[model samples]
Target: MKRIAIVLAAMLVTAAVPVGAVTAQQSSAESSAYAGTHVSFDASENAVTNYTVDGETVLQSVSTSSQANAGIGLDIALSAVTDIDASALSLGTTTETSATVQADSGATLNAHDNPKGTLVIAAGDESQYVTANLSGESKAEQVDDSRVVVENDNRTGTFIVVGDGEVTVNEEGNVSADLAEDSRLVFRSYDGERTAEDERSEELIANGSAAAEVYVMQENGSTVADTVTYDEQTTVETTSDAKDNVTMTIDRSVHEGTIVMTTVSEEALAATDNLSVTVDGEAAVEAESYSELQSAANGGDNSAYLVQETSADAESNVYVAVNHFSEREVSMTNDDSSTTDSTTADDETTSSSTNAPGFGIGVSVVALAGAALFARRRA
Candidate 1:
């Protein structure tokens, strides 16, 4: 049986109601930088009643299922501004950048500034879960299996669900999931004209650029998704071994899942000839399309990757997906003969490079463990 734990910070509890009843009490917190954005919580009911951004309501309400064994955990370290008997909610020194609410069952809902201007809501629990209800006229679209896009009156946001559970977006625009232990649900708001392109765009922007990125999906319904920006835990090294040739080697802990490599460089786009990838010292098989590559990766084939040229854009994104992890190397050479072939072919085939790398477009079948990492360029 799955149990739900709700942890609240610094609050006492006394009032008890029947199961599934909306709590009579509520608490609100405001974002300091974004003047009109705020979130309200129903402490007793263990639900977020309202969440607004820039004075516009984006979320109507968010509540856990009735099957949850609700309990509140309070953080006693921070100073509390308001106090109520039998209430399980706390507003501890709420700042413009951060706010937190936890329950005794280890469930937590946190709001913070992710990219300085954007508001991010992160909810996670080893035992509890919650479902979100979109506000008026808002619609939800599933970008992929793990991501959903929410469009409101004039703003857009994304939900990044990381776990072994299934995420569903109903016709009514409601979002729910059956999260496994160590699961996480992250919501980030994009105000004005900043729209979410796809799932990978959010991950890429959040994790930034690194030499290599590893996403590990464990078997226990938990994920270890993070970006390797430097050679701290994962080591990534790039070298030009030969003239007009480049090679990158990534070293990290060996894990039993898929490894994806993405590059958005004009040089890579122009020199898409003689691309080769190897994993665990074995040559990888190139898939004809992104879908085929995804199928091969999920099929447990440890030696599968994709390399293709769709157009002639200034910057093109390329993805290479492989099963398993360890020391892997990717080599690309700008052969003069291949260049001539490309030039002659370009004269015959008038194809423009407008499609970006299909990041998160049914790319990987497993859950992401860590942040998205990009390779550093050699100047």
Candidate 2:
């Protein structure tokens, strides 16, 4: 299911972008920060110590748009980060810790669970690691030339330095994290950061140790966008062996990150535990689709209508459309659209707003465990 969604998203992106063809905008994007930076795994195989002793070094500035110098453990070092982007990453496991990560003065390293035992991240003179399902202390430190490392010698470890942005993790899910704002990142449990030691926090969210968390980090005055429609159909199925509180959280801090769009949901089998799909600590965008996105109906048709726009006053706008239905109807459409002019938190629930708890979409379903497993395989 996760792979399918990824393919679907890629197809949509390809459709939106001409293949092997570059317009002035596309050509400019190549020189833009979020061009195309990939994660590298080779450094994960070259595990070593001295990272803790020397520590990850941060330099002055780096330009991701010019070089697109991306890969795990690129031995990078920089002071100011202008334009950069990433897809997905993770570190180590419970037993054999490792990582695929990046570290910079101003970058978000979104790491996820990597059962492969090692993940290495390097950005702007810093190198780090990521791990999954580990059970011991690992080491992290920076060396000269902005090189850092997480020694997965006796246990698992993950490392990185995240600037202001959002990181996400989900307990039960198959997804292609969507980053639709500048410098914003969407990641799984493997996401982490290496700050200057002033801003620090850590969390591991998932159903079991085998799972991973997701992340979405954004820099100030940045925007990251993905193909996620605010209101869309989604399906989540867990295997028979899946258990415990399955939850996901989008964590944001210090940096003024913003989330301006989102409108997809699956009412059946949504995220267990509390779910925060977006966390913007600073600025933000409007919900790109229907605020009240209704994607699934009675396990039948999965469809949603979306409208995108911004208010005139530069204020945020939330376009709401609920999914009300009559079972007798064959072809259906949204009966109404509820628009909220000014939303208040006290009179309502906490939103996926400015690092608040993630707003929930869809619903949670609890059935027999065996059946759930079957559903996952089918999904």
Candidate 3:
């Protein structure tokens, strides 16, 4: 049986309730910095929430299946001949939400076409993923460690995170969607990570020009003490004790902002050999199995994995399993008659402080053990 952690932070957000359409718009005083630009846009959503600048719709009704989508919307639009810029932009929704943005330049360059809004997803039993798309130049600051303040200087866009899911901010300078408590937010820009002052002080993973920053918040919306590890490599000795058995290696890495889990076996088997693997309790097949898990463990990806390999001779069978998570605290247990196993994380740890940016999305390590059991059949 799966145990649901009773997180206090997860309880604070008011569950979404049915509500009527709400909208708000704001205009700025003419600025010498942004010359030859006129602000114009039209933005509306379900039930008719709208924001317009100079007769153009920028933010529109965001379409999603989550009930948390019902709320107020704000839209701002601006135009320019050569370029557009702004120092500060602020708007509010009827829900009394006042989102503000301040940028060094080009803040309103694409206000009419940029995507903006909030989307909330509740935690669930299956694997899922979501992205927060914010356009223009924007910055997100964690104010009072309760909620993230994301503002864009240029375009109108929507952003959100639901329940205990993870949100990845892949681009630099654009704001990521706001995540409620009990969620994880991953950043890919080196600039954002610099502002975050990663607590573990782990060297930034080089992604050519790509940058990243990670955030993991508790149910109360406060930052938690967690480490983001990447490219972690571990090996499990499954048949060493059986006088003859195969070896398994588990390599964890990130690609295009997603967790790529690849498993390789030492036993060189013919095409007829039988090998089976299970990730997070889901069955996988063959000598090599590659699967992608969520970047954050708040979802189901951070769980146990089991691998079994049998040779053509059928002399012995080997089994291996690992449980993964992203917290400092860890627990492990296993009860099987056969198999050899060991697990350790080479990832570094940073101090968790609210004073520094300390924002980056990373995964956790959970319980894991090695034992050999008769291949139990699932009835």
Top candidate, metric lDDT:
1
Alpha-carbon shift of residue 45 in model 1 (angstroms) = 16
The C-alpha TM-scores of every prediction are 0.39, 0.18, 0.18
At residue 183, give the lDDT of candidate 1: 53
- Give lDDT tens digits, candidate 1, residues 24-62: 222223322122123333333445556666556677765
lDDT of 3 by residue, 1-379 (tens): 0112222122212122111211111122321111111222222221111332223332321111121331212231110111111122222221111122221211111121111122222222222222232333455543322233444343322232223332333344222232333232222222112233222111222211112111211212221211222222222211111211222323333222222221122222111133333443444322222221222221333432223332213212222223342211111112131253332111111222222122311111111111111111211
Clashes of each: 28, 103, 53
Once model 1 is optimally superposed onto the true structure by TM-score, how far is the C-alpha of residue 83 displaced, in angstroms?
21
Q: Select the stronger candidate by TM-score from 1 and 2.
A: 1
Weakest 10 consecutive residues of candidate 3 by summed lDDT: 363-372
Candidate 2: TM-score? 0.18
Best by TM-score: 1
Candidate 2, residues 1-379, lDDT tens digits: the string is 7665455555445444432354556544432121011222211212211222112211111112112333422442232221234223222221111122333332233222221111222232222122121112434333321122334333223222232221112121111111122222222111233232101111111101011111111112221111211111221111111111111222222122112122111111122222212111111121233222322211212322223222111211121111222111111111121131332112221112222123311111122333445546779
Q: Measured by TM-score, how close is model 3 to the native structure? A: 0.18
In order, candidate lDDTs are 0.44, 0.23, 0.24
